[model samples]
Target: MPPAHPFDFGAIDDDEGDTLHEECGVFGVIGVTDAANFVALGLHALQHRGQEAGGIVTHAPDVGFQSVRRFGYVRDNFTDPETMAMLPGQLGIGHVRYSTAGSKGQTAIRDVQPFFGEFAMGGAAIAHNGNITNANALRRELIERGSIFQSSSDSECIIHLMARSLQKTIPDRMEDALRRVEGAFSIVAMTRTKLIGVRDPLGVRPLVLGRIGDGWALSSETCALDIIGAEFIREIEPGEMIVITDKGIESTYPFRPKRPRFCIFEHVYFSRPDSILGGRSVYETREAIGRELAKEAPVEADLVCPVPDSGTPAAIGFSLESGIPYAMGIIRNQYMGRTFIEPTEQIRNMGVRLKLNVNRALIRGKRVILVDDSVVRGTTSRKIKEMILDAGAREVHFRIASPPTAWPCFYGVDTPQREKLLAATMSEEEMRDHLQVDSLRFISLDGLYRAVGESRGRDASAPQYCDACFSGEYPVEPADMVEQGFRPKTAAE
Candidate 1:
């Protein structure tokens, strides 16, 4: 049988011109009846991680394996009974995605994962989160060695590498494939009888294990587990791989040990507040960040206001710590998806107004402190400042939960290049002037570490988390990017 052509229904083009884009989310389950249904629910909870496309691959004893890939939101496609009916199995893996490594437009459907490969050992479907920085170099080598590529995704390189491995078992082959690869990866893969989960040596992305009845599941966040009524087991440790079968789960350490560099932004903006990460509630961590921000960057304001949803918890913490009353100054439109996930500037600008509006009554004659997750391009911040001032805010003070994002992220989060980042090119005063805020303050890097339970603060030599976006100290060397003349931006620059 010939391969199925990539599905390209109409494109869903919403724009997020100023915010950072999340990489992708992966989910897998084994030993369950109607496994695809649980995977759908898990994907729904992780929809915020990637809004562009979603795909699921499932294997059944009698029916073999099936896959369904689509462009647009998961709820739009995967929620339907008709779509779910096409995918039925005892073992399944799914992915919700935004392309950081592939082309855009209708053709991008080819890059939507969980990519399946029919290896000589049988069939394996892999769903990956986090970028493979050295993918191009590997791709060239693989192509030269007579490997035919299917998709433009960096992730496809893994499948090709696995095909050539001398290992007998699928798990061993996968481990062999990953050993040759570099950069951050948190992967969930499914074979006929087993579900496999692996996190990279530094664990730049998150992958967690869960239990549902007698079945086992792996997901990008604990929130996905909650949606499927799965009991949280524990996080998949860095450099670790787990293979789950009906018999039991087997663990393997495939990579040399290293200090884990979990992405700290997960607590700041990527994760849902309801999720737990690194053994702590993400909501509590953000709240602590807000309290720390208040201590480090105090300002006299009449009302402490969050930028809605993402900033609400931190704003509440700021209010408690600073003795300022909290109010709903900026009201988010619950009906709209995130503006940052949109693909164009024009649509993103329109989305900002459709997504958020100021509460005139709450802000009128008040010195409002706007607590936001982070400022990227300064476009959204500028627009919000204008909206607040127009609504009769006496003064608008900006407080950011995370430190200024000054560097691009290669390990998953889709940050702009250094030249495009507002912080990368401007000082705090310059950013304040550009955004036209009365004052702009970001939480210190030490404060962020403290909030995430690192009381002694970040060590310059060995940081606790992957803070490359703020500190420019990458845990993994970006070999491919460096070869292309990508240089890390210095603070002075």
Candidate 2:
């Protein structure tokens, strides 16, 4: 068969089915020269958050509102001079999507974001990261009240709600819309002359403000700001919204603020290592997690090897803390895309090995300690373990940076069904046996909190960050999931 078209994302199977995926990334800029270009760069930096599809919306007096939504990476779709020229504007917003809701593997163009809505005042386009827990109920209610939706995306619910609002300004309409919303959201929206950003009351996802030249930018991560040479201004506080235009910026708390419970996973894996989260370096935090793991679960091993890329920082810390030699025991093929086709069945069965090969020279006869960010399904971990043993390793040990993910994340992360999550079904010992590793250990939930700067660890009275995936103590009720018969953890559980 010939290579499928890039935008034919539905035809492709996910290459990284074992890992969690963030729903999307949002970026917007105002008053910059060709702001769309800056948004593109910002989106490119945030490609790790979402790789399935991307969209950019730009507004100029000449063009009014112009948008391009396409499947595949930003570089693949948005870098062309012709495409960039078409998006000419001094204000723009963009989204890169990995489907958490809507069409699953088979994404339609309509589902790709920077969703635009026409209002009585003007047209506004909004790019949103994070999932709306009450989207289904809201969607049903909105449809009953005569709101027509254009896409299967939950984020589009906001646009429709904005349309129905009695408020005069777009920002006011958004506040009205979001006040009715339940679940996590970090939004970057653009009107003809304004750029706006808002974080959900819980701040379950990330949104940062940055300054680039005379203009300002809002992005999902500070790393994105670095990509566009934007100075990090600070994170958008939970429940806060900022409207930026030539007159400068105005900030407000649209929703009642609750105790902040930012997504802890952003520190573990979702964010770029170079990014800063809650005034701490993501890389440094991961390193701290490794150090904590070493102290908590001390293991004797000949070599401490990272699972590659994401695992490297933690592995370095583990090696330093444990006084074990650090080596690259597994090598990743950097050029490989998440999905690829193999001509033969034999080649197809190679699976994870096609993407990661065991570094035999380093693995042979060595008791290797493999440090990985997280284990979701355990399929990838099992396969990697087998590859290591096949390469003549003396023993294989698995050190996971985060605690086991036992619950599905409803707030913007693409997670497997609860039953499908290996951690959800198995205990630590059972998981170790299932993977057939000599030993396996995950950083304790408290240890993870300490890594992220909670020196005394997670406070049971009121946990600081969202660790629902590990602890099953959801800070926000997943209304949509509960309506579908999903169970929440009881006190005993």
TM-scores of the models, in the order given: 0.94, 0.95
Expressed as tens digits, the lDDT of each residue in 302-381 for candidate 1 is 99999988999999999999999999988888877643554466655565678888999889999999999999889888
Candidate 1 ranges with C-alpha deviation above 4 Å: 1-15, 338-351, 455-463, 489-493
Model 1 residue 111 distance off true place after TM-score fit, in angstroms: 0.5
lDDT against the true structure, each candidate: 0.87, 0.87
Model 2 lDDT-worst window of ten: 1-10
Q: Write the per-residue lDDT of candidate 2 for residues 314-344, one digit (tens) a residue.
A: 9998999999999999999999875564236
Instruction: Score residue 78 of candidate 1 by CA lDDT.
Output: 88
Q: Identify the runs in model 2 with alpha carbons over 4 angstroms from their true place.
A: 1-15, 339-347, 455-463
**What RMSD, rounded to one decimal, does every model reach?**
4.1, 3.9
